[model samples]
Target: MADVFRSLNLLETLKESIEHNKLSDVKDAVEDLLISRINLAVIGDRGDEKATFINSLRGLSAGDDGAAPSQSPVAPEEMASYPDPKHSDFRLWDLPPAPSTSPFEPEGYMDRVKFARYNAVFMTFSQPPQPNTVEVFLEARSQQRQTVYFILFAAAKGTEKTLEETRKASLEVLTSQGVALPKVYLVRPSTLEKFDFPGLLEDMGRELPEIRAHALLLALPTLTSTLITQKKEAFQALVWAAASLSGGVSAIPVPFVASMVDCSVALRIISKAQLSLCLDDESVERLARQRGMEPTGLKALRTCALSVEVTKGEVKKRLAAAEKDLGTVSPKLVEMAMPRHARSASRSFTAMLQALGGAIEEMAADGGKIVAAALGEGK
Candidate 1:
């Protein structure tokens, strides 16, 4: 119910912006939505664990280009950064190990790593929380950094009972050290879709800012059905924004071809959705490699046309087809919300909304198929 209201409120806001000729603001909002940066800091003692975790987070193998070097030792006193090859705006920073001294100063360590810059922080450890790491978590909490997470990398395959026991022990250690309500996520870096990684992402999505959460959802690999659903919601919000922008742009008396501009906007949105949903050839190949399956098998599961190659011609065709189905595809709420004078502009808005909405749904379905095939779920 809250989500529905929120979406309606956003639509109302965008409608007013378009009616008031605030096109520049709408453009800026769209640009920010598409290109915002999200910095994630991973703090851990073991270099290899941190590197492997970072690579998995970025949907890259250790040997893949731009992947964090598994063999490279993390600097003891400095931070190292690994940018997501697909989305440069999303960066993962590897922070140095916590101070081992008896009287650890978390403030100094935070300052050294420029902790305030990160959107979220992940503290990786194998065993129970160390005193130094607990101090850092306490300091982060004191500073109101609510997105900090404790990650336990269980390298060995363990039973669910053993993993649950480890998590409880870690939380007990944190509470023993005066940290309140500590939550530890036990995960195997090689299989992030398992264990508590999905829960960790859900918590992060709830804690981070709305736009940053959307960026995180779109930037992450679609490893599970839950993630694909989340990505679909995010892209739906994006489609609303793009549709509103198209309507606003059409109202302007620009010299350039309006259809060309609309096609360009639709192309960019669909192409981005394609890659984010892991429907692209490269993303599919990487997922297949990670799961030790043939890429051809996973590719065969994609039933959407836009799931493979998103070309301008296809986008234009979708837009034109949507124009003809405007009466059916157009949302009644959007039409009712528009001012009587702007009914003409609603045509472009409705068409673009329907076109992009369809594309997103198809791609999301394809993403689900690929995930199932890769995981051997249907078999």
Candidate 2:
């Protein structure tokens, strides 16, 4: 068979090459190994987004005959107009707000190939808003263009004497691990309703849309949304804001801080086993049985960017320095806002990390960045 013959030939070649000290054969074998290693190194160097961006660069973005030429992009209004001029994968464009009533016209100074990175529109809160108003396209688009976005939505409660209880409750929910975090935007929804991508684009300030984010945490009620009154609008705004961040844009993960979780379960759907924590005595047992989790001494965690109506418990204790660092804590001593469980989680971590156990996320983020920087130096 072909396989048997190949195996015999390989063995003979290996023996003869080794016995005769054939340096050329050794060189060829090493070259093969080196090529494989380089391929792996290249893959490792390219992270998820970068790899995808490379494919898009090859005009392989569209299906079938959809690939655009790496040289010239199609329309001046195309998102590809802002490709990295140097073949880098990043870009940002700014354009003016298009007319609310009419279609958004593309500016003339754009690269016909890449649209997304071509125009950086500057938005003004004027009566008759105009796209391409002040300045239009900045420069030539190439492979090196790039951009990203970040939004912070702190839904923490504040210290208002009359609304002390309201503040505490909101804090509890925000800090609760099970609660969902919502996105926030100061978007002009009137433009959104009219299918005005350009106007919506205008609202986001026409920079190349890349990574969009929303961070929800403890904040004054009005600054966030009052649970009773503006809750609905706040929730809707969050969804719209995230949806608009598209095309190579990665939506930032929402960190649901229980301005008070006595403060964070992550997510997907709550399993039946997890849902029982919301019910009463008999109902708790019943739900537990239905969900395939143990019913005895059961407790549930209702967490999300939004609320999942449940009975909330109160804990009063001065939050340690870690919890206090969350930006919403009262410097004027809070009565009793303790997460005793946070201590257990902290037990396994460093002192500073443990103290901030109440904020699993901030600790991970800020801590990781610092650690990476420290480690990077040695490298």
Candidate 3:
């Protein structure tokens, strides 16, 4: 149909614009995909285990600001909510214990808590799923809610066999209900360095929509190599956008100036890329502190200053220097230099992108090393 053809053409045009690094077009496209809110609920008995797991998911250690409050013996009516420490839009709720009093119909409780409103609900327990937990999951599934089971191994830190037994028993509980087995993550909160935390994150990403998944990935600390690579690729697209914008500016002509394009465009792109990729100083420092290390030793972090902001003073100084060099040349000489100057500007822009790419690579590598060291991987 003609309508279909037109739609295809429009999409192709939009893709081309994004590829060419049109800032407004790219910004709009990215925004269009981010339409859903990422809200999750961690429901279980009144204990610190649920709070600890929530903190780990948000990349917060105990006592961190904005972290899920760690408390014991929570009241049945209590609900503790906390915005993600990194991305405030993504919120996590710590729901109180399922009410044990009489006249508590599972359906009524579900409706009262508005359980279906969240993107996902994590049913956490240290032991096998209790009757109340099973009732909650069944009611949640009936309402078409996404659910994941988290079995904490803090009490049993002995053999690998214990983990396997716990997992099998947990799966059997779901199987007994004739419902499909939902995702289950086995965690040891006391020692996050061990267990299946990384795989849990990967599974969550796989299950979530692309936009929410990317946001979750960005919010997570660089705990695995795959995460670092995904973050880097996300930033690489923005880097190309910056380079494309610079290329466009190179085509313009000016009387005295070498390049007519605004350097701030490229600078803004760099700043955004650095922050989104978690390569900014504050983000890196936080991750480093989480790993119990100083942030200064990494050479990749040293280039962070250049990516923050490119000031007008620096741009003016460079322009003045370029014009001063041209002042001595004749008018004909200046005319001849214009094309070369444009080419030079393009090359400089390319070089900036290259430097940024190199820095990202270094940051990813350093982050991986830090994670490996902290986890005692390959030791």
Candidate 4:
């Protein structure tokens, strides 16, 4: 058990630095985590259809001016790419649509696209996957890449039974082709909130690498509870990283008036988490409006601020609680060099993270209520 805690080298380094005042190391470590980008390639039978799907994935409506064109054709030679509307690091590429008339006629189709460059590939089809489509998918899979097959159908097509049939058919085809089945989803762009759209996003989150998954989750619009939880988990992991940074920086004296030791680092972590969670006023307002409520975004923002204070207060409370028992605790070699306040800073760091977690929980609960209420009103 002792070994487990000792194994967290970064956290130890972070706490030491913050307790003593080592700012440079914390800066470098934090910056290193901020710059990674995750690429996703979306390929389909038609360029226009692929673009529309891309738009839908980004949380835009097909008719919205900013939406990807569903009718505007992509020239055969062109490849289009778009940043996830919410994040620069997560990019989606519309690989030139598969060669329908001649499956492999273009000599360098596979070579030109460089399927391996992308972290994930999305193979979409409006109807059943044609031979050409399957061939391209097989080529992509041959690269040992993560590939997802999306079967998009119109809402008017049929009942849930019809959708299942389509899914089963796609499954049978892939099974017969001998391709290891990647995750598959059936969707209707018109009714995105209703069916498998959230499922598809969750599966993608599970499929991507950690940093990629983090970027993707943070960028995703908060449409479902599962998504909110994923975001919270991702953000919590990041907060640990932030705490590690605080611990690594050289220790600074606590501000004359403030009770918390490393206010700047804590604030930075909280701000970044807020941005990632879209807990900002504008984002909260937009989300509330989407669910058919008057603007309560500011109220949510206030809750986030209050959460931080609450967390700090809790940390102080814990420290006070531990004071009476300090006489019974034994000092170890690790504490020899740390200042008297080191213990307090550590407690404070923990409090900040807990506060952030509490804030997110409250925000999610409130947001869920609004969504549920709106959904009820719609019914």
Find the candidate with the highest lDDT and give its number: 1
Across 171-246, the per-residue lDDT of candidate 1 in tens digits comes to 8999999987778888888789988899999898788987788788889888789898878877777777777777
What lDDT would candidate 4 get against the real structure?
0.56
Cα RMSD for predicted model 2: 27.6
As for TM-score, the candidate ahead, 2 or 3, is: 3
TM-score of 2: 0.19
Cα-based TM-score, every candidate: 0.93, 0.19, 0.68, 0.70
Report per-prediction Cα RMSD to one decimal: 2.3, 27.6, 8.9, 6.7
lDDT of 2 by residue, 10-117 (tens): 223433343344534533432221121100000001122222223322222322243223332433233332332211222323221233333434344333323342
Model 3 per-residue lDDT at 312: 54
Worst 10 residues of 2 by lDDT: 36-45
> Candidate 1: lDDT over CA atoms?
0.81
lDDT of 4 by residue, 151-211 (tens): 5554455688877777787777777776665445766654456677777776776767655
Range of the 10 consecutive residues with the lowest summed lDDT in candidate 4: 328-337
lDDT of each: 0.81, 0.24, 0.56, 0.56
- Best prediction by TM-score: 1
Position 35, candidate 4: lDDT: 45
